[model samples]
Target: MNPSKTGLSFLWLSAVAFIADLATKYLVVTRFALYESIDILPFFNLTYVRNPGAAFSFLANHSGWQKIFFIVLAILISAMLVYFLFKNNAAQKLQNAAYALIIGGALANAADRAYHGFVVDFLDFYWQDWHYPVFNVADIAICVGAGLLALDAIKNGDKKKSEKKA
Candidate 1:
């Protein structure tokens, strides 16, 4: 299959995710001082912060090595996701969208790591004093993509079970 017309058709979704992430990060970085926060609601805030490590600040306490590690991992994962997209059938809309989102989110974060050494995060949600991790558009895309994949798995599992029972 010609990837450009086949699975690669989903690249548009990837581009949307990538562009959105960068744009939001750019706005946050330009408008907010580091660690500056503005409460938007009882459970939400816009808090500018930087994450040098992976999800939930994993390995964030290290000196500086985590930046390189995350960047490299993002690149590797993005490449792998592209490969998966290329191999996937165009009719597999759910999987294609999931892969595209993961690719875009990964590449966006990698670009941030390359240019800024850390991912700019601004969206914050909390309940009282306990706050969830601050994250940005790219993180949202990655998480949504993962959730979609899990939902696809559940849907397919049911189909397989029905086919077996028949």
Candidate 2:
């Protein structure tokens, strides 16, 4: 419940996640060719792809304006996540993890936007001929963090109900 502890935990998680994301992106950029696919498993593969747009290549076609808009959005979201970390009880691990995950992913993608004007995606999943959209570490962090946050909410809600009945 201590503010310092929460802030420290958040910083630790964010730093680790950010570093990992950056390292992975660097590896992918240096080692893989654009649109090249490396099969990692029967149902998964690492396929290098650059997405100038948002998730699932949304607005991938519009080149000029959408880039700036998405960059601004990512920055705003990162700022909001930081604010949430400061305002909420960071002592709660799940809440802290959620904030850290968001910050890390936002930072990773923002870095990509600044450097390359696009985000590097590689991870892919498929069943036979059906393939899912390729994604990267940042997207993974966002999804995992969101799931954790959702679970935390349900847990806290149950706690509140139990207290009310007692």
Candidate 3:
């Protein structure tokens, strides 16, 4: 693949993820009130909530400084991801896709923070009384991206070990 095509793939994937994240957030905000929960299954529900801090609502109870901190951090990370996407080899599709997903998710959440001072979250999961933190599409993408990267790293490590023995 040419660099242009590789770059386009990254951009397209990022756009899709970003759009999905934004669209889902809009629907949740419009269709549900803050903290409103609707049962969707035996172990899941859609609950509207907002987080002004990082994952799991870390620093959410602070006096409003964490929002700015997260926004800046996201921007920095996004810039680094973009740089890596462009500098990476065209053949590295897995890495490119991983970076794209992370970039998209980071930007989506950053936009929410910039506009509303928090990220809108709705997906909720629980088993009995144990509940997971509410999250949004962006958070899901980020997690999936990180998982892919980890898998790729393990594959590469195994390949190197095998090659060394050959």
Candidate 4:
């Protein structure tokens, strides 16, 4: 269960995700105006959006508290991810990848909040007249990371059950 071999790949993935997320956010902010949408597919589009709150703009309606709250939360989560990455011994491939994704996403959004007082969102998908909320690279990373971790946990649990029977 030693995870030393996976550490390098984890770090590399994290770095790549973080950098790419940041770079894309930067491009969105610098290249496109806020709330602008460009069609990308039959039901997808690239949109420039800024969210001051957490996912789905929960606290976005708040005048100012959202900035401080999201910033603090991102910092706390990022710190926890770093600790888990370096200490967890049973680092299954999915778990390791999950941590990297979470770290990168957290860092990317944090940077956006610090620089623009909000997070930048661009990807947009819709069906006919119904549109989904705009999201960005960071959100994708976080969501995928959670899924990977969940899958890893289930896989490991099944393995352990089989081992006990054997």
Please report the candidate that would top lDDT against the real structure.
1
Give candidate 1's TM-score: 0.94
Please, what are the lDDT tens digits per residue for candidate 2 over residues 44-107? 9999999988889999899468878888887898888887787776568887788789788878
Poorly placed runs, candidate 1 (over 4 Å) = none
Model 4 scores a C-alpha lDDT of 0.83
Question: What lDDT does the true structure give each of the candidates?
Answer: 0.90, 0.85, 0.89, 0.83
In model 1, the number of clashes is 0
Better-scoring candidate (lDDT), 2 or 3: 3
Candidate that scores best on TM-score: 1
Every model's TM-score: 0.94, 0.92, 0.93, 0.90
- Candidate 4: tens digits of C-alpha lDDT, residues 18-135: 8888888888888898788788899999999888888889988888888877888888987888677767654467887898898889888888898889888998999999989988
**Decreasing lDDT order of the candidates:** 1, 3, 2, 4
RMSD of each: 1.3, 1.8, 1.7, 2.3
Off by over 4 Å in 3: 5-8
> Considering summed lDDT, which 10 consecutive residues are worst modelled in model 3?
1-10
How many clashing residue pairs, candidate 3?
A: 0
Provide the global lDDT of candidate 1 against the true structure: 0.90
Off by over 4 Å in 4: 1-9
Q: Candidate 1 residues 1-166, lDDT tens each?
A: 7876566789899899999999999999899999999989999999999998888989989999888888888889888888888888888788888989988998999899899988899999999899999998999899988988998899888999999999
